[model samples]
Target: MSDVVKPAVPPPATPARALLPLVLPALVIGLGSSLLLAAVSEAAELFKDVLWETLPDAIGIGRWSVGWIMAVLTATGIAVGLVVWKAPGHAGPDPATTGLVDAPLSPRVVPGLLLATGLALAGGVSLGPENPITAANIALAYWLGRRLVPGSSGQVWAALGAAGTVGALFGTPVAAALILTESLAAAPRPQNPAERTPSLWDQLFAPLVAAGAGGVTSKLLGVPSFGLSLPAFDGPRWPDLLAALLVAPVAAVLGLAAVYAFPYVHRAFRMLPHPVLALTLGGVVLGLLGALGGHLTLFKGLDEIGELAADPKGHSAGALVMMTVVKLAAVLVACGSGFRGGRIFPSVFAGAAFGLAVHALVPAVEPSVAVTCGVLGLLLAVTRQGWLSLFTAAVIAPGIGLLPLLCLALLPAWLLVTGRPQMQLDESGAALR
Candidate 1:
């Protein structure tokens, strides 16, 4: 034995048998994640109808009136603020600083997060269910998985939960697979020469299973798919490629502007003496924007995106542009003021509107191409998630014909967003530079 003792020979790569035992647990985690997500969403919808329709109608007020919009949103802000300030675990963390996925939160924090998320969703906050749902699922999975699989690490449960929730959210295992694959690929590898490195699929096996289970369960539960039933792309022409090139990078630039503004906006809200005041003020501002942007600009963008797609020409270009701007502003305020939610859905909504606006101004561009490319660019800039951005764009437009053009469209848009500040803030209370 020399002074530098060689490392002991490591075992061979993880065998398939070793992973077989995990299948059941992964399935359980996936189903649980989807169930939790569905429960929250359904509850939110019930509350949303009560707030936006039933109560308003009962009171004999126009549900879409500016006064009603402002009042409900303001009241919502106060309620969410109180929850964040006093509820156990304070709803986990500031929405402005968090990403779609993070380390698992404490079990004690889950209830408060659910309450906050439900309120935000019902109140028409311009954020999505992705973030809080993912966090809560991870926490629950970790807590329960420890009892289920005593030897498993927290990372295992976290990955399973993330995969499950993402699948449920997008209504497809592909999205979860892409996201987890990207994440696993970036993880550091073992350095020992004797250690046999596991293949990518080896690492992905359990999570993919979890994702699949979650996706199927969500479908069985009748969750709406993300695919908008748009007119098919009539194959890509040179002009269509040109339209994509022109549209994508422009949308990326718009999203980048919002990214750059995010930290400063969060800081402004932080200056308020209390969470309640900050959130209430944010609600007031959102109400004003909603009053201007109209009903199309309210809520997370899933239904609104479909509504916009259903009748692309119904709104004037000016109206579409206004909807896009006001939605972006509302997302900024809702997130920065400690509201618990994600930005993806709202950005998707805004992207659809912006794309339609471009089409309204220039009818020569194909609606399918314009809308998909618009979604691609904005998601690229805002999420900084290449696979997810591409996947979402393709899902919304649904055609193999558009795939090649989307790949090309993503190139310039990616370059524009690469190395820029992400929408998330770091520990120093500044956007990641």
Candidate 2:
């Protein structure tokens, strides 16, 4: 018989039972990592109460004046500078240069990073705990994974770490899944289904499991969802479209301005031989911004954003625009310096301020919708992650009605930012184009 060799069929992707080893560990790490991250935030708040409120009240500095703001931020800079320069592991890598996913730094660096983050957060730096917390969680998770599940691949660890962090940060599995799906969708695939290459579902299964676990744990722990008290979107109308068209592009332009300035500021700070000097100088500048923008602009911006939204009409359009500028400037200073924190929260805050300004100017526009669109445009340019920007806008806007408006608004925003300078530092600390 003239025989033809047959290609063997790959066993139906590994059975669910085979995923048990990964699922269990991922669940554990995800939950534990989320708790750890939450704990850090909680601790920062506690210390903030002491440093900001308790201390101020104790000494009878009931209200913070510009001089006090300057003193505190400058002091923060000195402390952060010392940590970066003399601390072991150099307070980990510069956050501006890192991506959402990267190799974990040496375990030794963890303590310094945490210390620096706590110092910044409590001292009113315009940053969030996101980057530092994610890095810490990933390093911790990976370390445990290797010892506990030696058979697991690095891909699994990366996926689980990312999912866990996203879940913890956003308090939902959907954010993590959507973000990962976008990245994984275009990855190279093996033609042979029977090969060891994992199927997409199989690859996603554990991360989703981890994400779900982290999200559930956070909910159980009573973490709050992000939201603003505002009116719902009316059915998409011509005016709505027109407003979004005008708002998003303007937001994108503002974002580009920040992106352009990011590297130069970073370079200017880096030129200082001593980390202390760089961070100290950054703090002094931030103090001035806070002084000019008012106490609302001093911190990472979540609370300030809530305040802004609580009474959108209370502040005048000029005031909102000024807040936007000051906040953006604060973000540039915090990120460019050696502060151990994130830019996302401040970026969103700045975007919201810009949106509020637009709404004030164009009374035809809906306030909440403008805020959502502004956030979407800013994030689209800042993170270069379209889905995340859209998702976050929907999440923050408080209803499904705004989704259509946000989606339409995103298109024009994307065009403006697609090839522009990104808000990231290249290897040599220059803007990535």
Candidate 3:
């Protein structure tokens, strides 16, 4: 081979390596999207508060009165039906079934989804619009990215969209990044390993940009995302640790029981001829639960946190126990029967009630502290996110003094729930295919 041969050229960078080139842009886009989502949430909250204020007058009724509430429920059912019919994809399925993943959405469906979510919230369903808002944010980001980056892969755009949505909704860039990675693990994609691994640096930078955007947006829109700042505990005591240990097994049993119960309930409800009929039945169940447990079990429960905080004594310990059971049943029915909403808030409500009941029984641990730990522990079991549970416990508790105790409680709770069966779904809104 006497002829001089030219040196071989290296192969072009892999899609994964090429991720570096896109990172900065993706981060910027994520930040913008986060801010946009924050604005949406803020606006939605304002609209909801205003609606609540005027709703009684509009219906010519008293606030929280039986008639007024029933009117709200019926309107909520109709609105949900319209949204599901008009924008099928926008109506998010049960979060317990969907887990915490972000699903892709078409731009065409965003408006209808948003409208439906807003209407549903205004009508006072025992649901939160955060998931739908998150979906809409992701959809918008995907649409914008595709228009801007014509040759970009759908997977990349979808991931970016999800990242943006998470950053906006969570106010934690790191958390949002993790959520995106976890969510995309199940999505369809190219088989090449080289194309699969996005760089850590890019991942880190993208969420940071999105976080900044979210913070700025929240500030501009006057939305509150109260940081983690609980009161200092005297310290973690043996009693608290022992109590946590005791609670862990109980929580595990309850969680396992819930997973098994949800499917049967859902299957039974699915026998209804229509989604509306299914939801009407759900409304009746919730109404009965509400009537039994009082107004605490009726709504998405975000507003009730303040009341719970202000006067824990106002609620009889027995009522808390009953409310806990009733709310759990209501959430299971709501999700299983195909109502569109998130289970996170309802889970928190149930956990808080459970914790409060536990504290009442023990009388050794501070009720507030017990409530805080229970909230964190139960949510950790349900969501499978330790840090989020930690943060939630710290924030929701009246003081920070219980953080160490809460942390101690979370480990056993996690251990108990780990490896347990999770809710199964074939796809979005389809019967177990």
Candidate 4:
């Protein structure tokens, strides 16, 4: 959540009107950072296009092959490992150990980390673009802010930059605002009673401005939403509700299996003693999983999830189950071995696959409704953000009729997931590299 960084110079009890000036700076930083990262992301996709599509065509491989997939991922591991070894930032903080709101990193390390992340993304690594890009933007904001406003705390820029990135990535400031609320509200009161900390709204004001700007910028640039178009569900059937109540808990428990496995994998990867060896080995393992699960399990899985949603019944139940399992395993290996990315996208993919498989077995259940509930359970267990879990599920399967059923489903799922270890690392990172 939020770290309690006592501002060195106590912030004045400035009136609300006086705070309006900060919005301009926040907006500029937010838009600028998002634009910069957007370019980076586009380049990454192009690189991946060359590797996965263009290169394949040039080589005249009539179709995708397992051998080619294995070779690419393995080479990717070595390339990223080398960058980590020689790069200025050492790939920034170990992503496996870092939380969503990590301390700002030094500016010099941003480029190397950006390069490494691009390579990972292009290589079909089973990770999303959240972690490393946010880190890069934070550093960018801080470096620029120091020149523009030297007295301000670095935390301010870090928060705004992160909010901006989240907004841009999700195409909405709501996700960024909601996700950061816990951190903002949870900030511990300073030790000095005389010092008045800013109100939560005051703290959120700047971030919200940045998030709004970022969201607008992304929309203008035509970034798409993660919403899935499912079969028309006019009303929640009684059978669907019953099915959700039963299936949600199962999904929660299934996701927890990976949470339990994470730290162990983190520990094992750390034992390798070198980034080169650790990541290379991880990449090779991911290649094998890709071979097993096929192309659907590769990358961050956003596009692939859409593919499955577009044709839910195209694959058999067993195949869907294998997609979930192999993708989960790939997420663990990629994260544990130091490939920087967020857990949200991959977890959503895994959740959808699990739901599709369950729906295949229980024909009485509606596919979209079941998928939403399954996303609810999986996100609850994985991210432990209750509001976000519900919000994400409903948004993905946006039908007013589905909300009540999803809310009921969350109750049983919450119980199953509550008090369990989350898919996050402790601040100490004793078990992490």
Candidate 5:
């Protein structure tokens, strides 16, 4: 399944003249999208500091105190609820119903989505900024591109925008490329013989340009690398493969459990009278879990997971398990209740913690091997994208030596998750395809 086979008939070469028009537009979309992502992220960080730091100091309460954590989360839920209830476009559909790249939303929906996203991120809602940011950028790009370049297609701008946002989010173009490849491969080929089907590279060329620009802009802004700091593995061994097989499947199972529960959770939340009530109650549950699991289990899990990777041994097996379970539940609640964020970041964090816990218990599995396999499985189950799952795992635990092992280990997890319900939902609130 991983191998690439060439088509029987080659595609007609794309003219440089035809590509020139896209070059300028792709560059603009990439740069503008990155700036939008960065600005919103910084704004959220500012609010986060005030909510978790300055306010706590002013009130003379522990930042991690149960009451304080609950208060802030509940308040955030109310604020976001108001936005969803009153803001234009209702924040652009239930977040649980959306994927990383969907149809571009109305531009009117962007502000509310960004506001809700900012609140969710600031309040340690255990979600990341990917989905909403992508949606906002796509909307903005499509809206402006149609005006600025009258001949450009909406699909063109949407693709460029999605690619750019993905590149910025991951701090690399390869992730965008891999993700877009999966999407492009799913597209139906033209049936007419006279109308040549484009090769994968041709399909990806414009998006890649946009992704590169976004990635370079993000790097220039000094975002930290996505790779985690794990103890290096010496080499792949039979035992390590066995360890990966053991760890990856278990992590994938945990992720699938959440995927299975997603709709049920969303249904439960919808039973409430209002979005405000549902989200506020959801926030309370998250706060209780946070207090139980500690702050390590809060937020989107990127920085927290990095802290764990930096010193995997510092946490006990029990603590790691608590963190993983709490994070899984938090993601379900945060997203199910209509919080604007993505699951990938939280899932990555959960998988890493689970991997470290396995190491703590077994003591034989190498940290690098365990971490990568764990992440690979969880991402596979959560995102249901093969190349994406593999790429993310490799990025989190950077070691060329582990690539072959990861690829092989992915087979079992992929088999387990294939045909299962995805994390997203359809219009009727059932599991989306």
Candidate 6:
């Protein structure tokens, strides 16, 4: 008989003793990273605003029509291409695929991603800079953790970095925790022991530190925390709750349709001769939508929130419906044609428009409250982030105590939509082909 060898026993963890050593360092690194990210975001936003104010007139001297937009797109494309070519680590993958999870960037690549995203957003691309900001934050955090605590494993640093980054971006520790848990659930596992698993406790610790730092920095910098302080609605009425409940299934179906349609749209666009050609076609489609909606549907929809809120009833119901459809088409085309951006803002726009339409039909409910509930319900249904959806809706129309009604609307929609397969390809972009 052959001799049998016994399996080697692994060393045991030090239980509570080991936790203390990690706690302080993790907080230091997380908080530091969060503060740095806030500074970076403020600077980027200011610069973009300045560019938008000055660049259009300067570029418009020679040509009257489409000159500024064309110039912006070309410049943005070149900047993005350079970043992708030279600093692949900086170019965050499509946010739809990765959701809100953070991944570390090499220090060298952070600048490139930041610049690329800033230019793209400032240039009128239908995208937001948050994804790139989050990417850079995590990367910097990882680099700092590695430098300060040489003994820690790369995986530990990565988890810390992700938690910190999410906290900074969302401005809420609980939301960050939820994002981490969802991301960890979604991440695929490797067959080997060397591969790491992200733990729930690990997700909580760093995000908590980062959120504290972010809140402090946001207050100091005069940046909004994206939190809502809505006015109290007369105690939640059953009729309003029932109406919101009725809307849930509609939103859920729309979200499911979007996910299912995304891949096919993307594949169709990829058949173009080149990325530039694909994007130009996308621009044409967007321009047509803009013609129909009077330029409101063209960009990332950040500035339009105020317009949407202020003039919910000023425009005819037909205009709101037209804007909704055009904006949705523009988003689909933009994402399908290889434009790099996040869908969060666009989803907000779409949801808001949809809510406005719904309000037109049902006259009893307050328009603001109806829009708020609709936006939250649809965003949660599509993105599967109930907390983020709640916060976003509340912030958009603060002073309308609609959270309970919003939650009532959202929870069912989320249940209907969750566990459906995601539409975007994996980070490597392999699955899309």
Which residue pairs clash in candidate 2?
10-194
The top-ranked prediction according to lDDT is: 1
TM-score of each: 0.96, 0.93, 0.81, 0.92, 0.97, 0.78
lDDT of 5 by residue, 152-229 (tens): 688989999999999998888899999988988888877886998666787788888898889899889865446798
TM value for model 1: 0.96
In lDDT terms, how accurate is model 2? 0.84
Which portions of model 3 miss their true places by more than 4 Å?
1-51, 58-60, 88-97, 177-199, 226-232, 397-404, 428-433
Task: Put down candidate 2 lDDT per residue, 1-433, tens digits, no spaces.
Answer: 9999999655358786888878787898789868977787788889888877777777777457777788889999999999998889988898778766667777789899999999999899998887887888788777767777777676677678878888878899898888888878767776775555666677778888888888888888875446777776656778888888778888988988888888988888889888899999999999999889988887878788898988889889999999998998888889888798988888889999899888899877999778988999988888888888898888888678878888889999999999888888878886776
What is the C-alpha lDDT profile of model 6 across 242-353, one tens digit per residue?
7777665575566567666777777786677655566566556554555566556656776675577666666667777787767767667667665666677777777777
**TM-score between candidate 6 and the true structure:** 0.78
Q: After superposition, how far is residue 50 of candidate 2 from its true place, in Å?
A: 1.3
Better of 4 and 6 by TM-score: 4
lDDT of each: 0.90, 0.84, 0.63, 0.84, 0.89, 0.62
Q: In the order shown, what is each candidate's alpha-carbon RMSD?
A: 3.6, 3.7, 6.4, 5.1, 3.1, 6.4
Model 2: how far residue 341 lies from native, Å: 1.0
| Model 4 C-alpha lDDT versus the unseen true structure | 0.84
Q: Give stretches of model 5 more than 4 Å off.
A: 1-7
| lDDT of model number 1 | 0.90
What's the residue-level lDDT of 148 in candidate 3? 85
- Model 1: ten consecutive residues of lowest lDDT: 192-201
lDDT tens digits by residue: candidate 3, 1-433? 5988989544443455655666676667666666655555556567766655676677677766776566566666666665666565646554445554465677777777666656655555566655666677667766776788797666566556566655555555655655555554545664884555444455445545654565455555555442323233566677767776666456545655665677678877778877777777666666666667667777676666556655556676787878777777877776776666666676677777776677667678666666676677666656666666677667676566666667677777777766655444444433231
Please give, for residues 1-433, the per-residue lDDT of candidate 1 as tens digits.
Answer: 5598779664457877899988998999899999999999999999999999999999999999999999999999999999999999998888887888799899999999999999999998899999999999999998898877788798889999999999889888899889987887778777976566567677788988898889999999987667786777878899999999989999999999999888889999999999999999988988998999998898888898999998878999999999989999999989998889999999999888899999999999888988999999999999999999999999998588999999999999999999999999986778875
Q: What is model 5's C-alpha RMSD?
A: 3.1
